[model samples]
Structure formats: structure tokens, C-alpha cells
Target: MNELLEVLRHQAAHFGPELARTAFQRGLAVTKKDGTRQPIPITATPVILEAAEVRRRCELAARLSSAALKMAEAVLGGNSQEVLLGGLSPLERAIAERTWRQVSRLATTRVDFFVGAGQQPRALEVNTTIPAMQGYSDIAARVFLEVVARHFRYPERALASLLTLNGSNALALYRALLDGYAAERPGQMPETIALLCRRHDAQISELQYLAERFREFGADADVVHPEDVSGDDAFIAHGKTYQMVYRHLFVRRLEENPSPWIEDFFGTVPGRKAVFLNPPTSQVEEKVTFALLSQALATPELAEGAQLTPEELEAIRVSVPWTRRFRHGPTGGPMGESLEDLVATVAAEPQRFVLKRSWDYGGKAVFIGRSVGTVPYNERAQALYGAPLPWAELCERAVADPTGGGYVVQELVETSPEPHVLCTETGVLPTSLYVDYSAYASVGLARQPAWGGVCRGSMAEIVNIVGGGGVIPLITAEVAHKLLMAWKAL
Candidate 1:
């Protein structure tokens, strides 16, 4: 562990005074949620899971996400569709009901996991709409491997086989768009592909990187804001007409802030012509998908017979945690028990569960049971609805607001602390961090297998990059040794 710390110190030195922070900020271009670049706070020691184990988790994620997609799609035709999708807003539910033009449920997504003591990987959420951080992950992996190879004698060739690149995600995304176009409009491969997003998106750099990659893969690519596009059935950019367009903004935002461009994109000719990357289906993005999966696991028949296969059901039970849409009625538990009973149980042990919004992202509105004690939890409940009666009142509030914008209560996953040394001004400061493994899922002809993934660490309960935590680059022993020697020489 000390030797590994040595390598991290050396790599940190190589990046200049701030060490990895400088490289991360400039090289990786880590951006905050406010569209400003800041110094990255990366841990020296990376959590190195076995290559096979990483692949297994990734495969599980694919299976779970695919199954959830099918289940969400089933809402359009299923008899219990209304009850099943009661958590989504009417607009989101309506959007989900329609078959998207050429595109399927989730073309590109991400499954976040936390592997704890038993080494069993527990999935936190399925980011089915717009998943970021792949560009950073790709660059971090490359920098670690390349820098280590120059300074250390490691099995570079073998390691390459074992690990996967973040580039696969980019390739998968572009391939999905092109293939969808091919199927819908054969023999007319799109010459230009445009990435359409909001002007102030913090992930602009990532979008730019993907656009550059699309160009590399033999297609003209452009990154433009929503307001940039005008006219009928075509987006005009720099005097060129873009046939294929990738949407990075969510449907909720478009609805909340309606403009001429937004209205045209969702309502008029352009909405039908320009191909959306995600196709505006917000149901898949809802946290209720996990709740549905949890419910299905409890009562397989609740899946409505032929909608989900036994294997798919198994995947849900295996990967997904116990979840339920927070609502204001007498909800049925997985085993047909009353929701009131579940609430009573949760009240007895509030620290074991979490409550969050259904369709939100960036870790907003997440109320961890342990993080916020009984007083704050109740205070939050009271804040939601002017008065606080009891735990039952909160459950009622959740049920009352069962829409696409509803809230969900999920079982809290306990992740084991990963030992890490933070490289700082004085020296290496030892600390323990809770790490999360974020695996990217790409839509393609077959399952796009992922081996290695982006690992982020945080001292706080939440391990999101936006909250000051940063990426961890997994390297070998030889590389660590060289870094130690290099640091000593310095």
C-alpha cells in the first residue's frame, strides 16, 4: 500500500506543484456544475477491482438496464401500465408511450455501483438519459497507463487486454446514432451530426470531445446550442444543414423554459425531422424504474406475465436494490404487505434507507437516512408539506405526488471504505474514502462489453464528482515503484 502511495506521489509530482490536480483540471478539463473549471481532488490510490469482476458488474448493469427498458416500454401496452408508471408526470408518461423514431429505449446509459464487503456489486441508479464523465475516465486511464509504462516495468500488453477504454462508449454512442439512421434511412449515411445542448451546460467539454471523436470516425460534427437551430426540418449551423442531431438537454428543462426553438424542437416540423439521441422519453430516466424492478422481484406476476422474462427478473433481483415510489396512499410492499407497515419498519431503522426525487439528476434532493438524522428527516418532510404529522404523513405526501416528478424511497447501500492517500502541500495525507464504480452502457448490435470503469472517491456519503471528489486512476505495482523513485530523485 505504501509503495502504491509512492507511485501516486511521483505521478502527482509529474503534474507539477498541485500534482494530479493540475493535470486533472487542465488535461482532463474537470468542470464544475456551474460551467467553471476547477482543480480536481483525486486520490493517489485507485480501487483496483479484478478485471473479471469489473466485467461481471458491467454485464449485470447491461442486463438490468436492458430489462428496465423493456419494462418501461411495456407501460405503453400493459394493462397495469397506469399503476406501474404512476410515478411519472403525464407528459413524461405520454412521451414514453410513443415508439421513438428509429431509436429504442436507452441507446447510451450508465449504471453506478458500490461494491462492498462481500464484493457484491450493488447498483445505486441507472442514468438512462444523459450520462457524462466518460471522456474524463478515458483520459485518466490513458494518462495512468502511458505515464506508468514510461517509468515502470509493468505488463503493458496484458493489462491492455484486461482493461477497457472510455473511447468504446463514444464509439458505441456514435455507432448507435448512425445505425439507427441506416435502419430508418438506408444508403444515406449522415454526412453531418450535430450535438444539440443548452448554452450553459457544464459538460460542454465532454460534448466537444465526443464531437471531435465523431469527426475522427468519418462524420462532420458540430456542437451547437438549442437556440442555434431554426427553419423547417433542418438545423442550420455555420451555413450547413445537419440531418442528424444529438440532444443533450432533458425534456423537463425544455418544458419549464419554453422558447421559440424549444417549442419548435418539441412541437413543430423539426421535432419530427431531427433525430434526438434519447428521443425525449423521460420515464426511463425516472428513479421509479428501480422501484418497479424491486416490486417485480417481490411479485413476479406483477410484471404482468409475459412482459419480463425469468432471467430479466433475476437480473433485477440481483443488481437492483429494494426501492419504492414515495407516495401518499396505501402502497403495497413487494410481498403484498401494506406500505404503512414498511414505513413503520423504516421509522424503526431510518438509517438503512434513502429518499430522492424520481426524475432529478446530479444527486439533487437526495435525503439519506443516516446522513440526515430523525430530526432533519422529519423537518424535510414538514418542509415538503407545511405540516408534519408523523412518518405516515411523509408516505402520504409521496403517494399524493405520484408523477414523473414524484419522489422515491430506496434501500441505502453500504460501501466499504477504500484506503487512500490525498497528495497535498505538506505531504501525503492518509484518508479513507467511499468509492463508486461508474460503468458506461452503449447501445449497439450486440452487448457492448465494458471491462474497466471510472472510479470516483469521496469522504462524504455521496461520491459524485460535482461534490469535490475526483477520479481515481488504477495503476500497477511497477508503476508505483517508479513513481516512488522519481519522487525521491526530485
Candidate 2:
């Protein structure tokens, strides 16, 4: 591993320019809402991991997704409280159940994880909604591999032997969509599909990338915004009725406009109108969902509700960190300490935990106690708490309304920082950044694909791409082994 990093760094000049050119040519960029285009942060450094590690994380994501799936099934089968506790609004609940009844499967999702001390893997959050970056992973790992392989003078055929992009997230999602379409409209294949999102969404580039790939994979797919969506008995975008729809937009975004067509299109899901690739999943996508998964392992009431098997429970016990819905009143700590009020305990000893809104994205709602004094943390804390409270006040404020289900407290899992070279269009620079691994999983797909992990690194504890951290492509250990041997031979 050390040898690979050193060799790549030593040979930067030979491959850096091609890497910059490849990024632009392939459209590997994300947009701001204002439509300001920026290169998706690329780090030439690709984190290599054992294939088993990748498989475990994906399987764990699938298990929890299955837990969410069972929870969704329970809702479809008539129990709605679990999703409500997972933070879906009543209207959101109605939408989720309706969609779940129709779609009946989870197509794609991403699980975020951190490898803490002793190399213990801790599951942090599940990104069931818009679990992105499959395309970006392909572009990064494949591009970096191709460019560096060229620098190493490897022949064209040898390009693929170095690293695997896990059959590409786009293809995995494409296959899942096909299976969903078949399940919904058995014996029929959709001629056209729509990747729906709000116009100028931050992930526009990636959506476009996926749309094109879907088309390449044989589904005539288009990236469409809600405003353009129209239909009565079917989904009509750009005057064509798409038999399948992959909604990349959130319900809140849909509610913002609430046009008649948007209502008909989504509000009437899993129907004759079209097959939803990703059903309304905010129910299973919440941090509380994982908290419940964590809580279920210990609390029999939740355990019965979750219906996880012994195998699933064991995995959660080992991989899912200690977490609970953060609220006032009696609670137990990670070290078995008892407390009358979790809020007060957290306020008193803020260093041991992290707080996050049950439903949030882009790391905007994450607050780490150990980072209290730092400007980045302090500024974010001030914005969230209406003025940075003393640590105790911050803790008190972190607790959410139990009735509505708002916050989750997690035992902090400190991920180690390692050396990485940040790759950008301008140039590449060596730096040490805190990075975490994310594995993508598809629930309800008939055949599972080889899904490699995606990585993000940042200067702060909260590592998110939208927070301005960069993406590090992951190379499987097998590929790294081969690449290393080939490098030394050269």
C-alpha cells in the first residue's frame, strides 16, 4: 500500500494533465443551484480495500435496507408508526406507503461508514434516497487507472486488470430499474425512462451522466425536472409518456411546487401510470431508521418491531455504532453509564457523541462535540443553535421533540486521517485529510452486482462531498495487489 502511494506520487507529472483533461471531457462535474459549474473534487489517490470489506459493507447496507424494506412492508401491510418514528411526515407517510405498495422493492442506496480505532467498521448513516456517486466512481477510478496505466506504459487491454469500478453503479441501478419495471408490468420492458429531479439540482451532472448511461444500456432515458412533467393516466415529459420514472428529487422539493401534474405523477405512484425505480423512501432513509436498528438490538420492543434475524442482529451489533433517538429522559450510555436524562448527560459530556437531524443531507445538520472550539465547527454550531451555546447548552438544544422525531445521538467513531493527493483541474497537491468509506447496495434486485465502495475526505470530522470535501476512488485489494506487482516488475 505504501509502495503504491509512493509510486503514484512519484509519477504525478506524467498523469496529472491527462487526468485534468479526462475530467472535463467526460463531464465529471456537479452544479450549484445557481448553475455555477465546478469540477467534482477528484483526488488522484484511490483507497484500496479488500473485496470482502466492500462486500460486507454493501451487504450490511442491504440488510439495513432490508430492515427498512421490512419496515416499509410492515407499513404497506398496515403498521405506519415505524416510518413515522423514522421521521416521515404524515403526508410523507401516505406517499411512502402508496409508493411502497406499488414499487415493492428498494432499487439502490448508499451506506456511509467509518473505520475507527482497531480497524473496527462503524455504520454511520444510510443514504437510501438519492444514494449517488456511482457514475462519479467509474469516472474517477477508471480515469485515474487509465491515465496512470498509460503513464506506466501498460497496454490497452491491461487497463481493466488494475482496478474494478464494481460493474459501475449506473449499471447496477439500471439492472434494478429493469427488474422493478418487470415486477410492476410483468413481461413488459419500458421503452423510455425519466430520471426526475428539480431543475438545477446540485447533482445535475451525475443525473445527466446516469441518464446517458441508461440510454447506452438500452433504455431511452432523460433527466427531467418536475415543471416539465405532465400526465393524466401516465407520466409525460417533453410530450412523451415514460413507462418508468426514477425520482431523484425529494418530496419537499415536490411539495414546493405541488403542481397538478407533479401531484398526479408522484402522488399516484406504483400505479398504471409508471413504475417508480426508487419509491418514496424517506421513511427508510432517516438516521432514526439506523438508530432504531441500533436500538432494536438491545430494546425488545423495537427488536420485535424491526423483525431482524439473528444474523442481521449480530452484524448490527458489530458494525452499527451505539445510537438512539436523542431526547430528554432516562437513557444508557455507550460505556453502560446510566443517566436520568440523555440530553443532560450529553450536555455534560459532549465529547463522546455526535448529533444529527433525523432527516438531513450534505452534513449540514451534523454537530460534533469534540470540535466545539474550532472556527468551522463553531460557525456551523452557531448557525444551528442560534448562537453557539456553551457545550451544555448546545447539548440541551441538540435534543429533539420526541413526539415529532427529530435528532439522533451516536457514539463518536473517530476515523483516522491518512495521506492523499487532492486532484483538481488546476493541479494536484499532497495533503492529509480525514476520509470515510461509503458502500452502495441495491435491495430487491434479483442479482447483486459487484458494488465497490466510494470514499470522501475532508479537513473536518464531518466528511461530505457537498461540504467541499473530495471523492477518492476505491480500488479493491486484488487490483492493488496486481498493480503493485506490475509496478515493481516495471
Candidate 3:
């Protein structure tokens, strides 16, 4: 552990303090709605995985993606429509009904898992729409691996033989665009692909990176804002017409305010003009989908003649934690008695549950039953739910209230802390943190989905890069083994 810390310190020194400051201020710091900002943590030491473990996660990601796609199809197909779509808001339901004319229900997804005692893997959540940081992982891995090779004098071939190299999400996205084009146009190749974003979006760095990468790979890709494109018969951006538009903004926002821009992009301009990467459907992005999967697992008959097979249902059941989408009452609130019962249950065992919003991202609107102290929990709950009954009641009410439109309660899987040190701007130092095994799965041109992943380490209960958590490049098990051996030999 100490040797790994030393390696990280060396890497941080290589970047220098000036670059770190610039990156943190310009890139890492997240600006909240009230104009408050905080730096995003980054660790030089990476989370290492066994080759078998990498394969297992990849396969698991594929399965989860398949399950989510099936669930979306089931909702769209009217099989248990109310049961599957009941938990979503009106806009979500409307979008879920608009069948993606060209793409899969799930174009891409990220399965976040926590590996507990005896290496039992339990998925926390499935990020079904526009999962970010795929390209970041590739860049991080390249930099870290290069540093490791330089410091230890390892040959390129040896590193290549050990690692699961080439997980460029930018490439995967480009291919997915082509697949959508082929589906819509049939044999006619798309000449230009536009990476669409709202005007003055913060993710300009990522957009530029992906655009250059797409161009490098022989695709005429350009970063264009929605304002730049006119809602004409043909979608034109930057003086060039585009066949496909890769949306970087959330569909939920678009649904809130529908515009000619959206209609033109989605081919609602008389006839279908351009293919939207992730058609404005936020239902698949909601956490309620997990609850639906859990429900389907319990009642196989619910999936009768559905796209999901019995075996797939079983897989989803074991992989996802026990979850339920809380339903609202007729008087515009949670079911009163059921909410009370849920509060009582949380009071009995606070550590077992976590409440999350259906459409929130970046660790916002999350309440971990175990993270708060008894007094604080009650106070927070009371503040949130108009007078807290008890810690348990607070937990229950937290899940019941649809403050953010909808909510879901998930069984909290214990994520044991691992021994590690912080990779800071100053230097490396000891800090115990929990690590989350997260994999990004995308269905591109290939028959089998490709998987790239990141392992986030955080002192906070929720491990996310946005919440002062450090991201480590997830290396193959074999490469990790060799690195361990080398460290020991040293």
C-alpha cells in the first residue's frame, strides 16, 4: 500500500501543481444551482481488477443492459404498461411511449455495483441515459499506464498482454450513431454526425474531446449547440446537414419545454429527418425501472411472452437489490399508511435501506439510512417531511415523498472499506475509502455490447466522481497481478 502511494505521489508530481489547480478550477469543480462550487476529487492510484473479475463485470453489465432494454420495451409494448409505467411522471410516461424509431430502448447504460463480503456483487443503480466519464477513463488509463511503465521500465508488449486495452467510449458512440443511421436510412451511410448540446453547457470539454476523436476516426463529427441548428426540413448545423444527432442534454428538460429544435432533431419535422441518439425518453433513465425489474422477477407471469426470458429475469433478480418505486396517494402525497409502515421499518433497521430520487444524478437527492446519526436523521427527516416522527419514520417519509417527482427505496448493500491513501494536489496520504465497481455498457455496431468501466473511491457513503470521490483506472486482473508482483519484488 505504501509503495502504491509512492507511485501516486510521483505521478501527481509529474503533473505539477499548476496543472492540477487549473484542471480542478476549470474542470473538476461542480457548480450547484445556487452558484456554489466544489472540487471533484481524483486519485492517482487506480482500482485494480483481476482479468476474470473484469470479464465478470463486463458480462454482468451486458446482462443488466439487456434487462433494462427489455423493461423499456415491455412498457412501450403495453405489456403491464400501468405496472411498469405507473411510477413515472406524466412527461416520463409520454416519452416512454414514443418508440425510439431507430435505436435500442437502451443505447447505453452503466451498472454501479458494490462488492461486499465473500465478493458478493450487488448492483446499486443502473445509469441508463448518457452515462458520462467513459472517455475520461480511457485518457486516465493511458496517462497512469504510461507513468507506471516509465517508473518501472515495463515493456509496452507486457502491459498490452496484461490489460484490457481499447475502451474508447467516443468510438463506441460513433458506431452507435452509424447503427442508428443504418436502421433509419438502410445501407445509406451517414456523412456527418453532430454532437448536440444546449447553449453554454458546462460539458464543453467532453464535447470537444468526443468531436475530435470522431473526426480522427474518419467521421465528419462536429460539436453544435441546439441554437445553431435550424428546425428546417433538413437539420442543418454549422452550415452542414447532419444525419444523426448525439444528444448531451437530458431528455427530461426537453420534455419540460418542447420546441421546434427538439421536433426537428427527432424527425418530427413533417417526416423523420435526423436520428436522435437517445430519443427524448427519460423513463429508461429513472430508478423506477429497477423496481419494475424486481417486480417482474417475483412474478414471472408478469413477463409472460415478454422480451425478458425466465433466465434473464433470474439474473436481474440476483444482480439488483430489493427495490420498490413508492406510489403517491390520491390527495397528492404518498400512501399515508404505507408511508408510516415504511418509516417504522426503517426505524427498526436503519442501515438496511437507502432512499433515492427517480431522476436525480451526481449523488443528489439521496438519503442513506445509515449515514445520518439518530438525532440528525430525525431533524433532517422532520425538516423534509414536516416534522419527523423518529429516525425510522424519517427514513420512510424520505422514500415516500415524490419531492423530485418520484422515489425508490433500495436495500443498502454493505460496501466494506479498503485500505488506501488519498491522491491529493499536495501529496499522497493515508485515507480509508470505499470503492465502487462501475461498468459502462454500450450497444454499438457489434452484436455483443462493449464494456468499459471506472472504480470510484470516496470517503462519503455514495461513491461518485462529482462528490469529492477519486476515480481510479480499472485495470485488468492480470496486469494488476503483475504490478503487485513487481512491487513486491522491488
RMSD of each: 4.8, 2.5, 5.3
**Residues 1-490, model 1: lDDT tens digits:** 4765556655555432344543454345545557776645555565554455666666777777776676666654567666445655545554554443333534567788887787777888877766776656655555555544444444556445423332255665777677666655667788898887777566666678778879998999999876676756567766788878777776666666555665455432123566555566555557776677777876667676437767777777777777886643456753456666555655556567777778766664566766544544545556666654455445555555644457788888887677776654334566888888877664433446333467888886677776567777654344345444644565
Local lDDT at 232 for model 3? 54
Task: Give the Cα lDDT of each candidate.
Answer: 0.63, 0.74, 0.62
Candidates arranged by TM-score, highest first: 2, 3, 1
Give lDDT tens digits, candidate 3, residues 101-161: 3345345567888888868678887776667665556555554565565455566667655
Tally clashing residue pairs in candidate 1: 10
lDDT of candidate 2 over 1-490, digit per residue (tens): 7778788877765666678668646756768879987776667777877778778778877776677666545544556456444466555666765666555566788888888767766889878778888877777777777777666666668676554333467777788778867876879998999988888888788788888889989989999888887676778888998888888877777666666566556656565578876766776777777787887776876666657777678768888888987888897778767878888788877788888888777777788878888777678777776686677776666664443357889988977688877766667788888988888887777766666678888977788777777778777767766666767767
Q: Which consecutive 10 residues in model 3 have the weakest lDDT in total?
A: 328-337
Off by over 4 Å in 1: 1-6, 9-35, 79-94, 97-105, 151-168, 260-272, 304-306, 327-340, 374-405, 422-429, 443-452, 474-490
Candidate 3 residues lying further than 4 Å off, grouped into runs, are 1-39, 76-93, 100-105, 154-166, 255-258, 263-271, 327-343, 374-390, 403-405, 443-446, 481-490
lDDT of 2 at 43: 71
What are the models' TM-scores?
A: 0.80, 0.92, 0.81
Worst 10 residues of 2 by lDDT: 158-167
Best by the lDDT measure: 2
| TM value for model 1 | 0.80
